[model samples]
Target chain A: MKQLVRTIVLSDSYAQSSQNSPELEERDPYNRLLARQRGIRLPAELIRDNALTVSGLLNPEIGGRSVKPYQPAGYYQHLNFPRRKYAEDLNENQYRRGLYTHWQRTFLHPSMKAFDAPAREECTMVRESSSTPLQALVLLNDPSFVEAAKALAAESEDILDMFERALTRRPTAAEVAVLEELLASEESRFAADAEAVGQLLGVGMKGVSADQRSQLAAKTSVARGILNLQETITRY
Target chain B: MNPYFLDHLKRRTFLENSFTGIGAVALAGLLGRQESLGAPSGIPEAKSGTGILGEKRHRPVKVKRVIHLCMAGGQSHLESFDYKPKLAELDGKPMPASFTKGQQLAQLQKQAGKLKCMGPQFEFTKSGKSGQEISNVFPHLQKVADEIAIIRSMQTEQINHDPAHTFMNTGSIIPGRPSMGAWVNYGIGSEAEDLPGYVVLTSEGGGQGQPISSRQWSSGWLPSQYQGVQFQSKGDAVHYVANPPGVSRDAQGELVDSVNKMNRLFGKTRHDPEIEGRIAQYEMAFKMQASVPGLMDVSAEKPETLERYGCQPGDGSYAANCLLARRLAERGVRFIQLYHRGWDHHGGIKANFEKTANLVDQGTAALIRDLKDRGMLEDTLIIFGGEFGRTPMAQGSGRDHHINAFSMFLCGGGVNGGVTHGATDELGYAAMEDPVHVHDLHATMLHLLGIDHLRLTYRFQGRDFRLTDVFGHLIKPVLA
Candidate 1:
């Protein structure tokens, strides 16, 4: 069994290959010889982990009791056996890896379910990968993602830096242009409304000093756009 | 022969053996091509959002939609629809040991030896033209008695709450199977573009609210999209339906547009279909932001309509959910399940059952009447029942869970109203006449929706898994 495992791991097909290679472009169902460079979206746990890892909010510590991160209010409204009210982990556990997130067999965390996490009521052979509006909503509106965006904005120097932090590469000129325009518009909007800025900043446990509120909110918008990119969540 | 064994029959063997083999015959029937004796027709042709079965069904469609009103905890048949005067006369006497000898019992298992008979809690009156005897607690339902077909001999395998709920919903006590709503939605798809195909709404009041898990509506082993999306009556109708605190609607729209643009640009280099799917979902998410809020706003509903349902809009009551079910039916949601989780009456059967009945009776009758009035009754199927029934034997003032017999009702679309099918014994101990098992109910439901229960199978783990799972017989008397 060990020799078989070694042989399988050392196989030529297991070697890393560039996804962009023209040699991998066989379209026929039967005649396809090389593996294509299709990007598989990271599982629900890793998706959350990637966002936190890039934002520098991940606790990095492993092996502990399951944690509860920020979730929408009344997500557990239907849940009863004692009629639970979801209270997120207040300490650093809030930023812990998604692997440690509580697995409620019946009602799983919504954000995780959106990214195709199994309910774990029974053994699952393979996790299904689905793209739906709920996934978009999770990335765009879930407080955990929003909190990660805020943290990413605070740490980055600019939009390009934010892109680098999130996607592991600097954006093209066209991408930078679009983000700069979004940042400028968001800055003006936040400057006009102090309450909106306060709402955006007062998301997670961490708080920024009052002086850099508007600027930070604008950068967060830019950071949010970068984090929400399809490439950011997809593992090539 | 069990269809499960046919998974081992290879295609070459099936073809070479031709028309003589049992494997070929079963395969032909499963593929819905027994008449043709050739390749299955319309195998690849599916309706827009439907799963396997597509537009071509095994039989002619009778109902276009299904709305299951699940009374989550065990609802007693003795008090509700089943009229047993003999049980009332024998009340307070020791129950016949012959009836419950070695029978599965729930909370009353400990007191099995000294079990005392309990009569119907509420008074029964023959109501409507059919003279269907119903409990006085359901006064509103009594008015619409002729519009329903009551089944008194409903039997289930599981006696406990959670597993029985699973059995009632998915036709199996085991988890990880597509729910009834999921199966129906997957078969025909939905007409509502903005809303989900299968929608679940829940409310609780009157008794100890048992936890109705999200698994009740899950599309287990099926594609995730077919799973039921819970629409909360209060707050944001769907989780994350609302934008983040600071983001305006216009800002969110701008962000969506920008994200889609970036996705399209990324697609040029990657050539992955998922990128395009991601782009489409963002647009859908933005559309849901607008549609869901409008859907939840019931202020536009006329005062008379609100009065009929006996609910203030946005109060998160069963009445409001019934109203919403109608709205959802109108918009073409394929399956809508409204779970009222307060029916487990272990102690105070009379008072607790009455309170719970009051919570759902008016709304249930209102929904039936409203649908009939709207001309949607002909194509909409309404199922009202719980997981299982309560015992005839008493546990103090209440009853224990009984698997021998229960009651449920069918109304609207292809149902012979003003009729009672099947019956329990004189003592209301067990189903004596025409017992309707959970699988039979599932089969009949699928039959009404124009699907053959045996044919609508999903192959998983080398076995053809169906809702009925090798068991199911249609309850023919109730069919219109």
Candidate 2:
């Protein structure tokens, strides 16, 4: 049994493969060969952890009690027994790993649920992976993701640096073109509306300096696009 | 003949020989473009959003949708719909031992031998043309008694709050069965393109509110897509339905477009079907952002209509949820469940029940009337009940949980209105005549929606599991 375990663990089949093969190629039906790379969307916890790690906002303390990150206001409005108003963790615990997020069985963190995390009412043998609009909504608009994008923007030197930090690779020319256009449009919009800049930067626990608001907001939009890219959240 | 040609000839011969059989015809059509055969007679062609069974159903469809008003904490039948005059006569007297012996009781088990009868806390007057006896606590409901059919002999297996809710919602005491809403949505997919098929809304006030677990709405072994999506009564109806603060609608649209473009570029090289699915989901998410705010905004409703429901829009009360249920029904959400969680009264039954009833009474009646006014009630089934009923025996100022007998009412969706069906014993201790189990209720509900309870089976873990779980008898007499 030990020999079988070691052999399987050490096999070439265990190696990561790229998902860059051309479409419509005939391949193994039962997937006996490694075949074209198939990506597993990271689970809810790791999805958040990846964003925090890349943004340099992750509080890497080994272990403690669960944390409460940025969830929408009144997300637990329907919960009762003893009615509660969600008070998010104000300390560095706010940036803790998703594994440490407080688990409310009735109302699990919305982002976690959107990413198909189980409610923990029953033992989960396997977590189901679904590509859903709710997941897209979480990635695009959830405060946690938005704040991470803002933090990633604040820390990075430029758009290319943000791309490297988020995706672990420099953007292709085509990708760079799309992001640059987004950044330019967003910068002018934020430049005209000072309120918008404050709204964007006011999402997380950290506050932005007065002079850097407009620049940070535009870069945040670029950072957000990079974080939401399919490659950033998938493991091949 | 060549061996390959010989095999082809045999297959063609077999197809010609079994041409009368539907399967053979379908197989032959698949083998070649046999357009002349078309679909077999009596089989409906599949349509989008019609779920697993497609356009075909085991029976003719009666209701297009269901609105379940779940009184989450167990309600007292004695005070609500069942008028137990005999039990009232024995108020403060010792409960008959014959009925108490070997019976399961929740919380009142400690006072087993010392139990006393509690009289109905409210008055039940005969109402409407059919003279259905209803409590004064639900005055608005009494006014519409003619539109409802009351069943006073509803029985369940689980006696505790959580398990009873499980039995009521999933027709099983076990934790992991698909809820009835999930089953209905699975059987008949949603008509609302921008909204989920099954939606849950909850509110609590006036009594001890029990905690409701998300498990009650889970789809179990069924695909997660069928699970009930809970819409918050306050703030955004759906979490993340609103765009982030700095992101305007047009800006968000731009972001969605760029993301989809990147995804499509990725899809050109990779053959993952999930990429395509993600693209579709992104489009749907964009649509939801545009549609949900409009759906939740009840300001367009006339003043009198809002007045009838006794709520300001977005108050997160049961009344507000009832109004929202109507909107959801209009948008064609397949199953809408509203759980009012203030009915778990262990003390102050008289005051608390009245308070909770007031919270739901006008809204419940108003929803029925409003739907009727709009000509939608005929095809909309409305259910109003709780997981179980409170006990007949008194525990301090309130009652314990009872599973043997309870009451619920069905309205619209081809129910024989203004009638009472089934009965509890004289003491209101057990279901005595024409008893309806939780499974029976589920069966009747599916029957109304044109599903054969036995036929709507999902195979999981090498066995065929059904909502009724091998036990359900349609309550035929209640059908219109």
Candidate 3:
């Protein structure tokens, strides 16, 4: 199964753009006849796994048991029988594959839930692929995503280098300009309020050093936006 | 090919083959196209902040919103609403052979082995100007007794909890069907762009309330977008509603804008509708960041108001959820469902029912009062009931699951208040009057919301599926 997945993903068809001819679209819009490769969103597990892999935080161990990553507080109060309380595995466990994240049958992790993970309470034949405001929320605020951006920012101080490290391509000039503007704005904002910057750095499992906080914050912001780019989450 | 295998109709194949369903067909016809260019992923998106479907009411809407308070483990009609005085007289006696004739009892015959009549575990007294009979276990609900339409003969096909719940929620005894809330949202698009069209909040108290599966809120074959968005009472009202701890709102905003820019660029190149869906979702998430906090912060209400519903801010109590449901309705959520678990009492109905009842009664009553006070009641439909009723026969100290007949109550603008629309026999065992099946209840709710139950259909697998399935009556007397 692993080999099959790798070969399919590494194939030319997998790398083809979802962009296609209107004539083909008019003929087989759903690509039901396999007229062209379709651009589909990454699955819930792949999304997080992609982030962790790109961030260099991924611990690629073969799965054995479920691992708990940091999630929003009080997520499982909806389930009872001895109400559940999530305990974070902040070590290598937190950095494991997204598929390894512990899935409580009643309440899946919030990050997984936001990205359309099935609760697995019943046999799910086809997982529903959906886009919701919740996904944006998760991308912007989830610790895993944020930390991945932080690690990408830490990968290099050069913004262009960071882009290549994260997306594997030099960003277009226009995309670079967008990041530069965001970095300049974030730099001034954080410089003005060091305490606020400190507060931001204090959130999740790891914190960066204080001396380069503002630069790192700005880079982190740019990296976050890059990570959220459609191509980053899209295979093609 | 074997007939069953020949036309098995893999769901995806069928969906892709018949791309022409609603207005997409009209658009395809108008575009000088002889062949279909595929419809936008029919992922049930609310138009802007409105709901996904782009149509108006089929009739004048008497009620524009509905709150389904699900008593998950069937709350017994004998104790809660249905008044059968003779059951008390016949307490501790084996059910008359005549009453059990040709009857199939779940748990009673399957587990307990025999059936014995159980009396009303609580006293029923007349309350309100209409003198509606209510159990002593619910003094607070009694106060609003005049505001409700109680149906005593709601029946279903399933006898077990899971199937019974699936039947009550999705109009099917099988799993993988869009829930009634999903149907309502898909048909009527939401009035609020910031919140989901349909929202589900769950609270369990009785026993481990019948295990609730996500399937209850699944959109089934409907576009996944229409599924119920379960809101949590904590850190973020929804899983990702809040920005991660360190990210500032301004930074997040900039990130979203850039992301959208990239997404739009990709969308233009591919012309995929999923990209547009993602864009809308991001915008909705941005708006939700503001709207949800304000909505979930029920602390904004006065001290007196919180006390009325017995609510605690940030607590996942049924009371807090009931208050939240009203808040959601006020904010343009088209359908809000609260699964208040722990009502199933197969044993110790006398002991466990009261505990579960107390968790919901004050809040349920307060939601109606708050809506009426705000002058929103006329447009808000309130429904309170469970998958089925508890058996009239005693087991240990409780009753088994009874699919034969149970009671449900509807209130708010369209309901004919203080009226009892159906009834059970003197023993509270079987329907003797108007039998209001789950389909009938669904039909009446749709009617109140200005939808013709027959007209609001979603075609799937060469057939149009409805919340009422192949059954449903308008329940005319249910209307005011």
Q: Tell me how each candidate scores on DockQ against the true complex.
A: 0.28, 0.28, 0.36
Off by over 4 Å in 3: A1-46, A61-68, A73-93, A99-108, A113-131, A156-219, A229-236, B1-46, B51-55, B97-104, B109-113, B234-236, B244-248, B267-274
**Candidate 1 Cα outliers beyond 4 Å, as residue runs:** A1-53, A57-135, A157-222, A225-236, B1-48, B245-284
Backbone clashes in model 3, listed as residue pairs: A141-B244, B45-B52, B46-B51, B46-B52, B49-B193, B51-B189, B51-B190, B73-B344, B206-B342
Assess candidate 2 and give its lDDT.
0.80
**DockQ-based CAPRI category assigned to the predicted complex of candidate 1:** acceptable
- Arranged by lDDT, best first: 2, 1, 3
Q: What is the iRMS for every candidate structure?
A: 8.9, 10.5, 5.6
Query: Residue by residue across B1-480, what tens digits does model 3's lDDT show?
Result: 332221121121222212222223222322321112112244332235433234556667898888999999888999998988899998988777777777778777754435678999889889899888899999999999899988888898898877888898888987667788878876776787778888888887866566676667776655545667778754457766667655667767777887777666655555544555566567777878878879976657999889999978667888988888988998999899999879889887888888998888999999999999999999999989999898888887988888889999999987899888888999998888998888998999988988878767765554656789899998878789
Ordered list by TM-score, greatest first? 3, 2, 1
Model 2 chain B — which ten-residue stretch has the worst lDDT? B7-16
Tell me how many clashing residue pairs each candidate has.
0, 0, 9
Docking class of 2: acceptable
lDDT of 2 by residue, B1-480 (tens): 233222121112112222222222223223332222222354323332445555557778899999999998898999899999999999999999999998878999988899999999988999999899999999999999999999999999988888999988898887667899878876777788888778899898879878777678876655445667777786677678887787788888888888877776666555443455466567768888988999987778999999999997787899999999999999999999999998888899999999999999999999999999999999999999999998989989998888899999999978989989999999888999999998999999998988888877665433567899999998887899
Q: In terms of docking quality, how is candidate 3 classified?
A: acceptable
